[model samples]
Target: MGTTTMLVQCNCFDDVDVHANSVIGWQQTYDQLGAGHAHTTLKHLTAERFQIFRETFDKRIVQIGAAPAGRLCLAMPVCSSEPSVFQGKPLTGESVTVLHGGQEFFVQSPGGIDLLCVAVDIASLETFASREFSSADLCQLSRITRLDLEPAMIHRMRKHLERLIDNALVGEALSEAELEEQVLEFMLVLLDSALEWSVGRSANSTVSTYLVKQSQELALANQDEPPSVLDLCKHLNVSRSTLQRSFLSVTGLRPVEYLRALRLNIARRRLRSTETEQLTVARVASDLGFSHLGHFSGAYRTLFGETPSQTPRAR
Candidate 1:
């Protein structure tokens, strides 16, 4: 039988219950604060060798658990600002988290998470690794910590995923085998690259990056009432200069600017949502912490090249 692909979109926390029947068989529980709505887009590609899923969730605290499906799963959080706890350790945006199918692990994301998850059947992946090196070395892969991947590499991975999604949606049998082979090759390449980065990483750099990620998570979790720079510094137990430096190094934007951008994006999404079509531009601005409507509109226009009112509501 040829591979099967499915795309699913959910608009609220209650809507995610249907995902239990997915190939990965995830059991999820979510806690949503305020009147904010949640949105999710899930694309699943399943073939003989492996299954890959592109999942995105907006504005929800979710806990996910799944039983062993005899696969080795690798998850890359693509635009995740908040730190997710996997197996009790906080995972930042810089690493790809791996999970052995037999070993159950928990994932908790505060919100705004985009993940690319690839699950290769254990037997198939073992056979592929045997050709690469000693089969005994495959055991070490299970113990591997989060693997570092550069931003450029992640961007390219996303582009590849988009192509795969497009191809899957087209439902052409002629290129199905070729597309599967490409996806397998890409997964192998990612594994190889991750192995290389796992060997030698500096302690100092890791700590700095973790701090920056924490700051980001804090800022994102409190979007409705963002903290000031001094508040952040105090909460993180770091000096203002240290916080600023960390934000610059990690996100290339100051803390305030990053928070502003995040709020603006949230407003934009709400404006475009069909469920929130009744929300006016002024309400969105005030709810997102913009006291001056004019300033909010100007900033929104500068960032998105259109005023908030210009954004069309989703039908």
Candidate 2:
């Protein structure tokens, strides 16, 4: 869908999960896996059929989500504290990941990762591709998972994305049609690069991700009364050690720690919602299976750097 004018949104977040949901046109969640107060930023530009965004995570995080349907997402990390893993593949500065519409992806960051991403509607992209490219060429383009690029190429693309974001923020000289045209041109250059470079393909199997996703599904199904690590181990039919390793490998947190942190994150969200009439710290904590207000408050403060009582008012 094309709008007459562009939409620019820039926001900062203290909660990783909140930051995850701020990304325009994506279904994603960010789980904090490192220490310290969470400080994240999301800068987005939406125009016509294409969107561009820059996300910065200051702490270690496990990002689980999918790009919007009917679009192709191209992303590369602007910088990272360590090599971030995307779908089990390490994304170096020279490597770019291509995610097709509605494909679930996992990212594990050591800490401090800045990502630059672009999503273009697939139908519009194909219309442009059909002009000069063969059907087989388009097919190959759709199947690419990653592309290794030279430093100069990465720099060029980064600059283009940053410029678009800047122009959107400042209400710069570019008109709506001009912005759309620039986006289409950028997509063309990106597709051409995808064809020119050696494509990095995924493996036939992703057992680690399967286990993690299964566990997450199980855990979320009972989030109101979140199961313990032991309960999850029993339900998944995996030993405690195996489950622990799986959680640690896929997410940076241990099994028990991930569950607890997730519950805390959800609790924060509930407390922050204005829809929850007559909300209280005690009620929110109790509903999330936190029996002891004192202990819950301690854990909440440790993770979010604020007390539960402050959450509702912060909104």
User: Please, what is the whole-model Cα lDDT of each candidate in the order they appear?
Assistant: 0.65, 0.76
Off by over 4 Å in 2: 1-5, 197-315
Query: What digit string (tens of lDDT, one per residue) describes model 1 on residues 1-315?
Result: 123553322222334444334434444444443246556667776665566677666755555565356777777776777877776777666677777765666667766677777766677555445444334546667677566777678668767776666556655221334454455556666766665633433235566688777876887787766665555655777644455567777778877677788889999988888444578888988888676687789899999999887888876
Clashing pairs in 2: none
Give the number of the best model, judged by TM-score: 2
State, as a TM-score between 0 and 1, how close model 2 is to the true structure.
Answer: 0.60
Give residue 124's error in model 1 in angstroms.
Answer: 1.4
Model 1 score (lDDT)? 0.65
Clashes of 1: 0
RMSD of each: 18.4, 22.2
Tens digit per residue, CA lDDT, model 2, 91-154? 8888889899999999999978999998887886676565435588878887888877777888
Which ranges of candidate 1 are over 4 A from the true structure?
A: 1-14, 20-24, 27-35, 172-174, 197-315
